[model samples]
Every structure is written in structure tokens, then in C-alpha cells.
Target chain A: MASVETTRSGGDTGLPDLVLRGMTLGYLGWMVVLPIIALGFQSLVAGPQAFLDAVLDPQAVHALKLTVVTALVMVVINVVMGTATAWVLVRYEFPGKKVMNALIDLPFAVPTVVTGLMLVLLYGPSSVLGTILGTYGFSVIYSQPGIVLALLFVSYPFVIRSVQPVLLELDRAEEEAAATMGASGWLTFWRVTLPTLAPAIFTGAALSFGRALGEFGSVILVAGNQPMKTKTTPLYVFGEIESGNKQGAMAVSLVLLALSLGVLISLNLYQRRWSLEDGK
Target chain B: MKTRVQGLAFFFLALGVGLVAGCGGSSGPDASGDVIKLGAYSVVREAFHDALIPAFQEHWKQKTGRVVRFEESYNASGAQARAIASGFDADVAILSHTGDMNQLVEAKRVSPDWAKNPTGGIVTHSVVVIGHREGNPKAIADWSDLAKPGVGVLYPDPKTSGGARWNINAIYGSAYLASKAAGGGTPDLAAVADLLKRVQANVVNMDASGRQSMSSFSERGIGDAVVTYENEILLRKREGKPIEYVVPEATLLIESPAAVVDSSVEKHKNREVATEFLAFLTSVEGQKILASYGFRPVDQTSPLLPEFPKPAKLFTMADLGGWDEVQTAVYGPKGLWTSIFSDQGK
Candidate 1:
């Protein structure tokens, strides 16, 4: 035990360093590295041609385009609404403020399927509003609009939660000092407040975008799942599985996996740069 | 503590591996030595879970000191097929459609001849039609009437629901009534196909399951008329809804076939008993039980009918050239159904 400790601590000659290195490598290999390797191997056997076929299918292509587009659009909408929501909650004093603040997170508590089913119940063609929407030729369910609505419901909390802390940390005295300098309300916010909030808002939006991309339970119920017109990538994968297509499910998962990883890595790099800048 | 952790880990690992190996032999807890496991659709499962399972257990115990059991997952055919394809363990699967069984055949879990047996055994079957809130206010008498202005129709997706296909076939038959050149008395397949195009337009919701669709339609007032099995209509009507059913002219017939799994058929060591179970399902007694359960019997022309009987040669799966042909003609890309309803009934 003493000898092993001595070698491990490099107290004596370091001849067994190779063994230590191999052991360290093995731990990571089994835990972190091997599962990724297995995923790649499974994808290879699940028919590379079929994967390509599924991704390239006209229906899937449209769904992918719609998913990415809706997710991005949702992230943009939520960032503004969510940050404002957080700003109001953290920076205000009013009656019923706590209730209003908690309501922002109502979306998070609702089961996604319930969210979707509720939306249809409220706005489907059969509902009163649905009939009005139908009368106006502006349907929400069974259309692209419903996809965005579901995405927004699930993605709203990411921004509100992320922005709230950063907003609370914001020195309000700076705004007061800027007001003393005769700076306008808009100018005080733009110059003093916006930069600090950007990082947090972006982080929230990144998470929201990813959540929207992978969401399944809610969107299918409301989207009407009309093949090419309203089908999302997740629905397409589900349909393929039902059609006895395994390779297609893998391919769809690969696309989702690749996009999520890319966004997360880019986000990490982004936050790293911002932190470095703040340090300097 | 470290040793204990290792011991727990080893035990769980062995357990997991054992469970995976036991996957194919999966039978319900009620299985006695002489009985076989049968996976069933909703009605059969409802019976097994609520009534038949206990009865079968008691019957076998009293007669031969054995028990019959079932492992059930009851819902839409498409979901069931996907579950089976993803390695849901079952000795025998009785789904709402042959399409699901075909999935098992492709997986090499069941054989091609799984449907052939003494019963030609349709465990349960039903007539389907438009169900409305009392008074039939829209006066919907036939399938064509479903397209009337402001007629909000609710039906399950044909891709998923076995009963939904009969609705599809009924719609096809009605379309031919207006245009025989397309497919009608002269058996014009093209005319029938063309007629299906128009009916596809008025559909509001393409629900993935039958039970939920019916429940929502009745319980939540989701639609004006519901497309579903007569059994479901009967079940729903019993739930105190103001509902009435209208069977369209010359509506399509729905048939459900069931047989013991290939391995069970051969390996049960008592083929007589196995065959007897399936045989009992088709006898006059069995047929009567099915009728009482809201199913249409095999004999179409019989008196005291609960619903329409199975149609003749004109009403056959062979006439449509099997499931694959149906998929190609109606469900595939460039499919007539898609081309017609592309804009959702525009």
C-alpha cells in the first residue's frame, strides 16, 4: 500500500506512470467515451442509406425546415416576452405581483400533452374561438401556427427563469445615476442594462430553441400531424417507426442529436468568451 | 459498503440480463401449465381484464387444474405495431388489424399462416357509422351526407385504427353510388378510388386511436358526428349521451381474425386443447356471444341480427388485393387520398 501510494503520488521513480495513465484513460473510456462509440456503431448498422433516405424524404425535409424555423421564431418571441416578464417581476412592487410572477412559470408546470390538448380545446375548430378563427380563415390547430404556439408554451420559462436572476443582480443605482446625468429612460436601459442581460437572454434562448426542437407530446396533438404540411421531424420519426422503419428513426435522432450538440457547444464557447471578457 | 455496492450491482446486472432472456417467454401471472398467453385488442382485453381472465382461471382450475392467461396492450393498430417492432414481449398478439400482425411476421416473431385456424377466428367485429348528438339534426343518412356543409366529422386515423378502415371503405362504397364508372355495381375500382377523394375532404381530426376519439367526441362534444364501430357507439350511448347511429347505404364490413401464436400452436404439447380453444370461438355458441357483445356475426343473412353480417365475395379483402395494395393505392406517395385531401377538403 505504501509503495502504491508512493508511485501514485510520484514520491519515488515514476516508472508506473504509464499504468496510472492507462487506468485514468480506462475510466473515461468506459463511462464517457464508450457510449458515444456505441451510438455511432448503432447508426452505422441502422442503414446509412436508409438514414439518408429518411432525412432526405420530402416529408421529413419539410418537417425539419418547419421545426428549425418555428424553434428559432419561438426563441426570438420568448426572449423579449420572458426578459420583460422577469424585469417586471424582479424590478417592481404592486398588488398581486407574486401571483403574476408565479404565473410566468405556469407553462413549466403544465404537462405538455395537457398544454396541447388544452390549446385545442380552447382554439380548435369545434371551440367557440375555433369557430371564430374558422370564420376568419385563420386556423391555429392543424397548421404551422399551432406548432409555434406549442413551442412558445414549453419554451417561455427558460427565458423568464434565466433572466430573473441576472436582472435582480443588476445595480438599480446605475440607472438612478444615469437619470441624474440626464440620460433618458430608453438610453439608460440601452447603455446600462442591455449588455448584462444579453448573455442570460441568449443562454435562455439557446435552451428554449433546443426544447422546441425535440418537443413531441404537445405538438402532435394540436398540429393535426398533416403529413408534409404540419408534420414535425419528431412526428416523422414516430410515423416511420410505425411503418416498420428502424433506420429512419435512427436517422431522425442523429439529426436532432447533431443540431443540439452543435448549439450547446457554440453556447458554451459563447459564455466562455463573455466570461473571459468580463474577467479582463 | 464498497463490497455491498458491488454485491448489489452484480445482483441487478444478473436480474436485468435474466429479464431480457425471459422476454420471449413472457406470460401473464395467471398462466398455469396447460394454458397459453394471448395478447389481445381492446374488447378482448377488456373482457380478459374485467371478466374472462378470472373466469378462465377458475374454469381451468375446475376442469384440468390449469389456468389460461393474457398479456394485453389495447389501443390503435399502428401504435401496437410500433410497440411490437420495438421488442414488446408477446407470445400471441391479437390486434385490430392484420397490418400489425404483418409487423410481427417481418420481425420473425409470428408466421404467415397465423390467421389460418379452425375458427377463421374473428374474435370480435362491428359495423361502423356516423354517430350524432340526439335527433340526427343534420339528417345524415349515408356516407355522402358526411360532406354536407357545416358537418364537422370526427374519425380515427385509418393508418392507426383498424375500425377506421371500414369507415374508409364505407366512404369508398358510397362514392361509387354517385359514380359507378369509378367503381360500383360494375366493380369499377377507379370510380371507387375517385369517390374516396371527396370524402377525405371533410375530416376535421385524424385521431390516432379509436377509444379516445369516441370518448372526446361524446364526452367533450368534439364533433358533430363520430365515425366509429357500432360496439363503441353502443358503449358510448350507454354512457348517457344523446347519441344515435346512422349506417350508410351498403357500408363496408369489418372483420377481425385471431389465432394462437405459431410457437404456442406447435409447442403447447396439447394441440387438441389449443385448437379447441380457437374452434370454440367460431361455433354457433361463440357467434351468439359475439352478437351479444355488439359484434356482427359471420352469417350475414341470419335473423335476430344485432348488426350487419359479413358481406359476400364483393365484400372481401382479396377484392382489394390485400394490405400492401391498399397502402400503395391509397396510403403511398402520389396516393389518390393524399392528392385529393392535400389541402384538407379544399
Candidate 2:
């Protein structure tokens, strides 16, 4: 309580400080808290039995399972591939390296629906690769694989963007020292570089997974939107709304909101702990 | 600390007030209440936007001394209906199916006697027709041909799309009629369910709308044939796209309904203008405009365009016990369509 009083009084606080604090709180309340509160009340409006029925519906359960499984898979793929991409961009010099680095953010720039369309065009049944795979009864688009592919495209830049700056700021002296001690490239990367990169990689992977959990546009376009098959939670919520089931839609939406909020809180806590460790 | 908490509470209270103000305060009458909002389904979007609206404006201007301005929003029928029912403030709603209008009627957003008008609550009509690649390579002439091996069928999902529900009912109803004609007995639900199952097996993907499914067939080359609205096929043909379409014998007639949303019109106090707009939609001149855009006019006696081909056997929603019974029987829990695709059906 003393520290809080000192923070308010000890600084060169002015009207701008008060005004800015008010503005920030106003924006946060109006945009974030209000909508979430509205959704919360709407979900509970139908009472406990209806809420349970919506959450435990067979299609809802299957969609939740699919959403989680696909997001987890996306986290793993992005952590590895995105880290590799960042490492290559930072370390290697190639003819088109600059273009490739810029191209890494294209997924973020292009619309999700366009990404889904491109994936379906390239790997759907119309393509040569798709045809060969279809012969073996392995389909890409309109299946679980397509959902993962779309998630990978959208979440591609997360880990790369997170790890790139860390890699750039990292001192390479330790890796050079390890090299002089006769450590192999893989050994140096494993024992030295990866340890330092772990925190950024995990943070970015968590963010990517959180994003995948709420993905709807690209997943709906490519995953065929088959209930209890490739339908994700967001798509299920959409279906519920379109079918005039507002209670069911609100319930599923609250589920997604809770999951994303959990991710955000955990990430915030992780960052706070790391900052405390760095301060000490 | 207590002051800060009070500030936070005041902020939230202000936010709640702002939300209510933002939503509720916009719909009051301006200087003059000559503006009417029209919410419609996507299949009729181009027609309403391009052909019908301009003509209606001209007609209204000629009929009345003052000009009427319209604000329109279009999407899936069910989506539009939900928006209107949940307070989107649409004065008149032109939807793709009776199911959506029925939902609004049930919600009291629309008047119960909306159908007591001239055209029986429907304004536009079409049949579930098939669109195929140029030259008709699959030789698909009827619904049963889609069930043949190696034929990939494309249609939207019934769960989200009103048009898709009509398409599915067309398939089921056509099969039931065929079976009944052969035996002179009532439709066997088992046989009808089996036919639907066979067609479901060839489904490449159930897109969200008839327009989307048509694009997946025509542009993406995903499926061999698409079940879509007859007007969509005619519109594409008019566009000189290298596509051919056939209306199957014994197909379900798609009856799209229009209504003056009672609550919205009453709120806006534009009930007279909204009613006029709806009546104009089913008028002879309006029917002609709809025909130009490939929609079969709701007035059966109205002259159809020369380019529009009539289906040999057209069945109404009544043939299959209307949308409620059909939705329950085919798309409901333990519904045959759901069971045919997955084990999730009760």
C-alpha cells in the first residue's frame, strides 16, 4: 500500500498521466471486457442444463477434440519449421534469401480464405500430387490434414518472428567457442543454441496454438466443414448460429473464449516470471 | 485504492451505457422516414442489387412523388433471418426458403399473417437443377445419375444453407415420387433414405452455400456435378461461361419468401413504404425483372422469359410435407441424411 501511494505521488505525474490511464482503461473496457461479459451472460441465459447440453453435444465434443488436436499439431510443426526458417535466414546467405525472408510474412498479409483456396488448388484432388495421393486413398483438402495445412500457413510467422530477433541479438561467441573445442554443428546447435532459444520458441508456439484454436475461415474452406469429422469449434459455433441455435452458439463461443483467455493468462504469467528472474 | 475501484466501476458502467446507446439510438426516425432496409439471401443478391432495385426505385418514383432510398444487406438465408430476428433492423426480408421466414415468424419478428397476401408468402421460385462442365462429360441428366459410381456430387451443407436444404429435399422427394409412381403406394422412408445415402457417398464437399458449391464445381473443378438453383445456372450461361445445366424431372421447386418485418417496420414507422416495396417485388414489372435475372416469378400466370426453360415435373414443398417436416425427417437427430454421412445421427 505504501509502494502504491509512493508510485502515484513520487513521480512527476500530470493531467496527461491521468488522462492516458483513463483512455487505456476506457478502450479496454469498451472493446474487450464488455463483449466478453455480454457473451458470458448470453451463454448462461439458457441455464445450466442447456449449457451442459450444448457443451456436451456429440458434435460439439468432436469439434472441440478436433480443434485441440489440430492446434497442438500446428504448435509442433510451427515450432520446428519456423525455428528452422529463422535460423536459415539469420545464418545463411543465398541468392534469394532476402526475398525468402520477406515471403515468410506473406501468410500474415494474405487473407485466410485466399490461403485456403491456394492450398486447395495446389493439393486438392485437381492437382497432380493430389491425384497420386488420392489413388492411395489419402486425401489432403477436405480432411484433417487440410486443417493442419491451413493452420500451418496462418501460424507460420509466429515462431519465426519471435525467434528471429532473439537470434539476431544473441552473441555467437559461445557457439564459436564450442566449435574451437571440436563440437560438431548439431552438437553445438543442440547443447548451446537451442537452450537459449527455448523460451522464445515456446512463447511463439503457445501463441500459434491459441490462434489455431479459433481459426475458422481457412479451416471452413478446406476442411469440408463436416460435423464430427473436420469441423472445428469455431465452425461449429457458426453452424449453431446459422441454424438459429443462439444458446448453443453462445455456449461454444464461451468455450473458445475461455481457452484463448487461458492461453493469454499463462503467457502473461510466464513473461512475468522470466522478467522477475532477469531482474534478480 | 477505493477511488481507483470506483473509477473502474464507473468506466464499466459508461461502457454498458455506450453499448446500449450505440445499438438502440441509431434506428430512430431521421428528418424524414423514407429509408427502408432490405435484408435478403445471397442467391437473390445480384438480382436485387443490379436489376430489381433500380427498377423498383423507378417504379416507386413514378407511383409516388417522393423518392425512396433503400439500404440492403445480403447473406445466407438463415444468416439473414437470424440477423433480422436478433435485431438487425431490416424492414423487409427476402429469404431463400420458408424455413428461415418461419423462424422469424416464430420469433414474432414478422407478422403471423405475412402469408395471407397475394403470392402465398413467396415471391421468387426456382427448381433444384444440376450444373455440369462444358459438353456434359458425366452425362448426368437426373438425380439418380449422380449416385452412379465415379460421379462426384457437389452441394452445400443443409445445416447452414437454406438452399442446400431445398436441394436435399429435392433429391429425397424426387426419389420418393419415383418409387411411389412405380408401386402406387405411399413413399417408403427406407427407400427414400437409401437413395439419399447413395448420393451422399459421392459428395466431394458440402460448401456453405449453393453459390460456393457452384464455384467449387465450375472454378475449382472439384466435383463432376453441382446441385444448385436453376437461376444460378441460367445466370452463368448468360455470362457465356462454358457450362451446361439440366433441370431434373421431378425436382423440388425452391420457393423463396419475402415479408415486411413487423417489428422493424413498426420501429422505423416505414410500414407503408415497406409494404409497398414487398408488393412491388411480386408485381408484374417486378416479376419481369426477376425473370430477366433467371428467377422464376412467383406469379405462375406471369409471363416467363423466353430463355428460361421449365422443368418437366416441378414439386412444391407441400409434396414433401413442407420445410418443418422435411427438416425434422432428413436433417434432424436420427435424420437419414445425418446418419448416411456419419454415426453421429440418433
Candidate 3:
């Protein structure tokens, strides 16, 4: 790693470095920045009053609140379950461990629509389990829980993948020292290991939260898309666009885009801080 | 590392060339025949693709001694209208309602006088009705039955579905007409709004489209009843699905419009073929094909009319003061239907 860094720094002034940098920035500007600017412009095209009305519409507000709440729920669950899965993968020797490791990424590969359909088939009213649950006055599909479930499925791999590498590279020396000092396994994890994993956990949580905010395909199927009830922001945006309320669609979309941008930027800053502390 | 980078560049270049070649292959019109692009609502896709297009092709060939190819595009009505208005370049537009067609007119893609024809430019007709599971477990007979407690109903969100607007309009119109009859010509807006709110409260799922609502009712078995077009239920039953529907005694008539997009027809030099296609849609042969697909023909005297039972108090948009008034009263900002959802959230 040191040698590679030395070579890179040695050639930092070369034509290839400049070309690569320019190409990356140019590609990113065209693909990502340009579209975001266009969306920003369109959202304000009808003037600030129209933009405010669209954003402040009761249905839009409810949809935005629902999306944020569901995404938060998904992020909380992902952080706990994902950290445990990563820990188990790093510390335990179990049958099918290799397969389980690979399976963690299956959610990423599967189309989000298929993910929604799978959830619906599993927990929809027609299924036996869903029927039993319904008989007990519990429904999953076409309700709030279904929205969270869909969000969870689509964002499942974020935390696990983010924390797994950090867990793997973690030295056991600190954990052993804590153990020698009469710390319990859970205590050692909390005091010695958890601090090291905190940044990674936050990274995963933020990424999944960002991803869950924009999730549509799976959420739409399971959400039932009742305005001010089950509809999330993305679905609301879709409804607005289809209904010819283009201003409302653009306004809500800008909110989501801003939120996702905020998450990524914060993640970048947090990681930079961590790296600076590591350099110390 | 440098060689790897060069290899990656070459790969991307090859992929770009391949993509360009693939796109170029299919986009050009055939040299030997004329092409007419048809942008239509999704519900008419089966009728057009399976029967109308082929029949028209044969007729045109026999009459003009030239082969004419069709480029078909079908989407939900509003989306299709928006697409054509925003330059989909479809030579013809067949949509679910005049409101969508009006959108094209406003965009100047279609002429305002497109409706100056024998059928008022409408190609097909249907009535809003209630679709239920076989055996009529819910005993749903009218719009008010959908508002009954403990009965789950399905309809698409009107914000996204032109069909949902029709469904909701049927419910609202039935109530409004009843109030008008009782009050000796004064329609009670409050009663209409009340009925809409009650039915919406019973709606278990508001799918994105009418087709999705039907699937949710039939395939997923989620709802006890579905408010949809009469043609949708008939089409399903004809496809061997065990579904039954009831035409409410008082329901709104669904008149779907079609027209030659003047801009696109002129651009494609397809005025003659496009004009003929619209003419054929109202002709006896075209009406028969549409009727076979469960759509009520615009020509009330057509032989296929016998298959469609007439509702006792059938009402067109004119009964509610036409599309412009209905749009503002039912679906506009602060509209009755729009406010119902917001009021529920409170």
C-alpha cells in the first residue's frame, strides 16, 4: 500500500492523472450535477409561492413525513441486525458461512419491483400467514409495516457490507486486553470494539437511510398508495406528475434530492474526520 | 495499470459503437411502406393490436394498393397525452377522456375542432360500474353499497389514473343526480361529497392504475369489490376470469376520444391514413371489433349494441356541465374528491 501510494504521488503531476481527474469530474458533472441543477430549476420555475404551496400541500407533507418515518425505522433495524450479522460473519465459524456472506448481497442484485412482489406474496392478504395474521387483527401488506418491510428489503445490505470489512480488519488485541481486565464479552464489544465500529455503523445507517428515502418500486406495490395514508414521497411525486401537477412533483422531488445530498455530504465529512483522527 | 486503463477505454468505445448501431437499426421507418404512429390509452391496446390495426391494414391495402405499417404506443391516458403533447410524434391520439385530449389541444398538437364529427370524435364508450367477486358475496349493487361498513373496496388513485376519475365520478354523479331528482333539479353538493368520502373510507387500496386495481381485486384477492369501468370487468370475464359486475342504476358515461394529431399527421404526411383510421373506428366494422372487446360502440344503433345493457339513468359529462366543470369541481385544487383525502388525514 505504501509503495503504491509513493508511485501515485510520484506520478501525480503526469498527464494521465490530469486526464483521469478531468474525465471523472466531467462525467460526474454531466450525469449527476446537471440533472440536479435542472430539477432545482424546474422546481422553482413556477415561482416561490407555487413552490411553497406544492411543498406545503397537506398530502405532500403527510407523504414526506411517512417516508422519513419509515426510512428511520428501517435504518434503526438495519443498524442493529446488520451489525450483528457482520459480527457473526467475522467472529463465528458456522456451516454455510460462505454462502451466507454471499447471500447478504442478494437484495442488491434483485430488482426492487421483484422485492416488493416477493414481500406482497409472502405477507399479502391471500397468503396463509397473512390470513392468520389478519385473523388476529394484524395486517402487513398495504399498510405502514409493509412500507417499512419494503424499505428494509431494498436497503438490507448497506449496513452489513459497510461494517463487514471494518470488522474483518479489526485487531483482536484490544478485545483480549479488555477481557483480561475482567470485561464480559458484551462489555468488551460495547467498550472496546463498538467505538471502533461506530463510524462504520453510522456510515451504513446514513447510506441506507438515503437509499430508503428514494425507494419507489417496492414501496409503491406494498404501500397501497393512499394519499395522506400509505403514500410516501416518491409515490406522491409520481402521482403528482401523472396528475399534471408537475410543479408539485418537482418540489417534492427537490426535497428528496436535498435530503439524499445532505446524507452523502455528512457521511463524507464524518469519514474525513475519522481519517484525520486515525492520522493522529 | 496504464495498459488496463487503455483496455477499459477501448471496451467503452466498443460498447458505445454497439449501442449506437443497435439504436439505429430499428428506429428508421421502412422504405417500402407508410408508417402511422398510434399513441393510445392502455385499455384499448388489446382491441387495437389484436383486431383494429390488422383490420385497418387489410382494408387500407385493399383500397389503396399500398402496405401501411403501424407504430403503436399505449400508456395510461394522461401519460400518453402528455407524451404526445411533449413530442412523441404519434400521428394519432386515442385517449380515455376529453380532458386528456384537451391537454393535447392546449399544447397545439391537436386541433380544437377535432371533435367536429358524427361521433363527436369519440371512438369508444363504457360506463362506470362495480366489479365484484363471483357469487356477489357483498351484494354490491350501487355506489352506496361500496360505502357500507365491513366491505373492502378497490379503486385506483384519481391523481394517477384517468380511470379512477371515472370511477369516482360515477359515485359522485350517482349521488348528485339522486339529490337533484329529490330536490326537484337542485343537486346537493354536500351529499355528493359525503358519498365520495364514505366510499373512499372503504377503499382498501388505491392502485396506480385501473388495471392494477383489477389485479389487486382478482389476482391478489385483496378487496371485496372494485369500482371500475364496465368494459374492464367484461374484458376480464371474456378472458375466462370469473368476475361479475353490476351497472349502477345511475352512473356516469365514459366517452373516450380519439383524433388525428394535426402536427404529427402533417409532419408524417399521414393525413389521409390518419383521417381514415379515425373514420374506421366509428364505422360498423370497427365498432363491431370494439364491441367484441367489451367496449360499447359510439353508434348506438349498431348490431353489437344488444350485448351491452343500457343503464336506467345513464349520464354523460354534459349532465355534470362537461369536462371543464367536472375537472374543477371533482379533481381540481380544493376540489371535492381532492379534499376528501386531505380531510381524512386530519
Candidate 4:
């Protein structure tokens, strides 16, 4: 609390402190706030009715719905798989464990477009696996599943990274006490470990969901980009802008920007509350 | 501690100033020589970069006894037109269709009467054709064949690609002609919509640009046929890629136009060179190079004209009541083509 207060006030309202604070805030405002304000102004320039029309346009609505649904699907799978990955990394020792941990962050480093291309190479209609899946009538590429798959790849590291540190730092004494009290291993994990990991899992899920919402490069290649079908919101915005419908593009972009901002703001609030509880 | 904070602040301020300066510091045309910026659609990238620009530089140098460097940019036709209209500052603009050119005119970047030239501002000619695998296993002879069940098709999304609009227009136009013939001079809009819907249903993927669609067809092997320009398939063949294509019996004539962007040329003081470059593209020598690159020459009298076969029932934008009418009738909200997706729910 003392450290927090000192950092908040910067110990003194001296010239260097004011200069540092002003510069940081100015940089953020210039780089981030300005563009968001510009987008909002452009979309609202024609009035709220136009903005509503653009957002509610059947094609636009369909794109927004598709983006949200695919992201949600990705989040559900990521929560399960990512939690399992973190669990194994922390609770077990194995060969190549270090290499596996390093490789988990590779998805974040690789370009999203390359991620899209890699996925297409593996699951496109002509690939051996894709052809095999096609015979079963469960096509992957150029469909909703492909969209979710690309989202999963791009957001793969989010949940795992968030949960790993929490898992490592977790106090094992409570689980041991539960086991010594006759609780089964699964029961101990559910009653003791999961509650501690829930916040980290939620943070990871929220972060990945926000990331997936704006995933353009990877999803655009796999999604067939059929309007009212595979086209996502970012693709719709690009199409509108390229086709000289700037108003429509701006309106849809504003919607996405607002959605991502809402997610990040709520995550911040949740983390702040959780940290306060932890401090107690 | 205070000095460290001050140093960090100075560092950030300098970084900000440097970023701003870097973005604004692009050099203008050099005074010792002339330069012309050419903004064109993506399909013409190979032709312009490899053949036309070098040929034009030689022609300009021989005529004026001065070096004329060219700056080139190629994008989807509509995107290219939007770029030029929004201050991209290209002295010359070559696009896939008049509708895109008209966008520049409306923006006052080009003269309203820019098409008043020997070639009506059109520098190249092509036709909407179907590109299939070698030997054409599916036998996609016409637009109707593309609508058949189990026949996978590929075309770019028209909203982003001007070439895709032409491909879709060809299908719609052919269907319109058939409906007109059956209705004894009255075209059936419903029939055109039905055919477009069916073909759209079979489309395996719709990439953002025509080049991407061609790649999806040739490299990915995702579709049985690709609705694209004849010149695209010819260019692939020139590269020794085994590709087969068909010129549909009734197809829309693809007229690609080039015009000097008045605002850009005026700003760069490059009007003279830019004007001459457009003139050269229609000249017999220029036409010859374009023809070699698979573009149909605009000048019908050029010897290369015979190499391009005429379609049985060739039609123009005017035949479909011009670009403005077609834009509204096909692409506008509630237009036939636009509504097809909504009604079919695909």
C-alpha cells in the first residue's frame, strides 16, 4: 500500500515528475486516443441514424454475429486446452518441457497472415487431411470451423501464459491438507486449485476473446469471405472501405472498437478488485 | 532520479518528433529529370512492371532526350481508384473499368471529359472468361455450366475487387441476354438473379483480389473453374503454367481505361510527360507490347487485333444501360445481385 501510494503520487509534484507524467499521457493520447476519436467522429458525422443503419445492415449484422460466435467458440476450447497445458507445465516434469514452454509463445511472434497460410496449407480443401475430412462431410477450411481454428492458433498462448505463473506460485499446502483429510485428487483440484486459478483463467479467456474479435489477417484467408456467410466484421470493414463506402466502414470499425474497449475496461476492473482482495 | 526521468521524457519527445518528420519527409520529383507516378489495378502489374514501363521509358527518352523515371503502384481497381481520389498523388491512373475511373472524375481528380480520346480513354481490352484446369475435366463451356451442382467455382469478392465485378457482370449479362431472347426482347431480371445465386452457391471461396482468386485456383487447386479475365490465363501460360480457359459464347467486353490524374499531374508539374505516356499506350508500338502480355489492344487496326478472337455476342457497358445503371441494378442496396445473398441465406 505504501509503495502503491508513493508510485501514484510520484513522492513529489516536482518538475521532472510532472514532465514524465505529462509526456506519457500525451503519448498515449496522441497515438491511441486520437485515432479512436477520429473514427467515432467520422462514423457519427452523418448522424446517429446513419451509424445505426450501417451497423444494422443485414450484411454488417451477419458479419458481427459471425465474428462473435467464432471468438466465443475459440474461447471455450482455449479455456479447457490452455488450462490443461499450464497444469502439465507446472505440476509435472518431462523431456522437452523447456522447449515446449518456449514454443508456446511462438504463435504470438509469428505473423498472423503466416498463421493463416499455415492453417490453409494443413486444412485447405485440396490437402490430404482436408480431403479426408471432406469425405466425412465435415469441411474445415473456408468455413466457420476454419475461422475458429485460426482464432485458436492466434490466441493459443493467451490463457496458458496467464495461468502458468499463477499455477507455479500456487501454495501446495492446501492441496496436501485436503488430500490428508481424505479428499480425492480430483476433489482437491476442484475444491482447492481451481478457485485460485479461476481469475487467471478468466483474464486469459477475456484477453483472447478480445484478440479474436479483431483477428483479420488469419481469419480473412480461411473464411471464404462470402457476405452474410463467412465474412467477419473486420473483412466487412475492409470491403466497405475498398468499395468506397467509408461511412459504413467507419461505423463498423467503431462498433468493434467499442466492443474491444468494453472487454479491456471490464478486465481491468475485475483485476483491480481481485488484487485488492488479495492484498487483504 | 530526476535526471533519469528528464532523460526519458526527452527521449520520448524526440521519438515523437522523429516519427512525425519521417512520415512527412518523402522526396518530391527530382529537378534534374522528369518522373511520372503510375497508379494502376493489380492485374496490370506484371505487364506494366516488366514490359510497358521499360518500353515507355525508352520511348520517352528517345523522344525528349531526357530520363523519365516511373513510380508505380498496383492494387485492386476500386482500391486503386479510391487511393488516387484520396491524395495518393499518382500522375497517371489505369483501372479495370469505367466505373472506377468515374469515381476519380467525381472526386475532381480527373477531368469530367477524360474519356474524350482516340480510344475513349481505354488503353486495353479483355473479356470475362472461365479458367479451368488443363484439359477442362468439368467441361465448363458457359455461364450455365458454372452453376451446375458439385462444380466448385472461384471468384473474388466484388466489393473489394473491380475484376470480380466484371466476372459477375459477364454471368449476369449472359443470363440477361438469354432471358431477353426468350422473352422476345424483354430481359428477365429474375432469371439473371437466379443464375447469379446458383453460381454464387458453388463458389468455393471469394478472395479479396483477382490475383488472389487466380492463385486460389492454380496454386491451391480448390475449385474446378475460376471466372477471371482471359489475359490472366494467358499470362500464366506465358509463364509455362499449364492452365486452360474458355471464352464464353456471350460475355461482356472488358475495357480497361487509363487517364491522367489532373490534380496529381498539376501538383507535380508532370502533365506533359503524363499526357504523352497515355498517348503512347494507344500507339501501335505500345499496343503491340500490351498484346504480347495478353492484353487485347485498344486500337482495332493494330496487327495484334487478329490474335484475339471476337466473342459470338460481345457486349459493352452501354449495352447494359451503362455503368451507372448497372451499378445500381446489380450492386446497390436491394439490387438484384445484392439481394440474391439475402434471399438465398448462403
In candidate 2, what are the lDDT values of residues A20-65, reduced to their tens digit? 8889999999998999999999899889999998898788888999
True contacts kept of each: 0.16, 0.58, 0.92, 0.82
lDDT of 1 by residue, A12-36 (tens): 4465777877888999999977876
Candidate 2 ranges with C-alpha deviation above 4 Å? A1-23, A93-96, A127-138, A171-173, A268-280, B1-35, B176-187, B267-270, B301-313, B341-346
Scanning candidate 1 chain B in windows of ten residues, the lowest lDDT window is B309-318
Question: Residue B166 of candidate 3: its Cα lDDT?
Answer: 89
lDDT of 4 at A181: 100
lDDT per residue as tens, model 1, B1-346: 9999999999999999999879846643333466554556664544446544455556556767665554456655666655655666544566766666676778766667776664354566666667987788888887767777777787766655666666676676445444554433466656566556545555666666677677767766766788887767765444455468776655555667665555545654545455555654565655665665566676655565445533332344445566666666666655655455443421
Going through the candidates in order, state the TM-score of chain A alone for each one.
Answer: 0.85, 0.93, 0.95, 0.96
The candidates' DockQ values read 0.26, 0.33, 0.73, 0.61
For model 3, residues B200-257, the per-residue Cα lDDT tens digits are 8888888888999999999988988998888888788778985888888998889999
Highest-TM-score candidate: 3
Candidate 2 chain B worst ten-residue window by lDDT: B301-310
Task: Provide the lDDT at A172 for model 3.
Answer: 93
| DockQ comparison, 3 vs 4, better candidate | 3
List candidate 1 segments past 4 Å from native: A1-49, A99-103, A124-138, A172-174, B1-35, B51-71, B81-89, B118-121, B172-198, B238-242, B264-274, B301-314, B338-346
Tens-digit lDDT track for model 4 on A110-151? 999999999999999999999999999998899899999999
> Which regions in candidate 3 have their CA more than 4 angstroms from the true location?
A1-7, B1-19, B22-25, B303-307
Evaluate candidate 1 and give its CAPRI docking class based on DockQ: acceptable
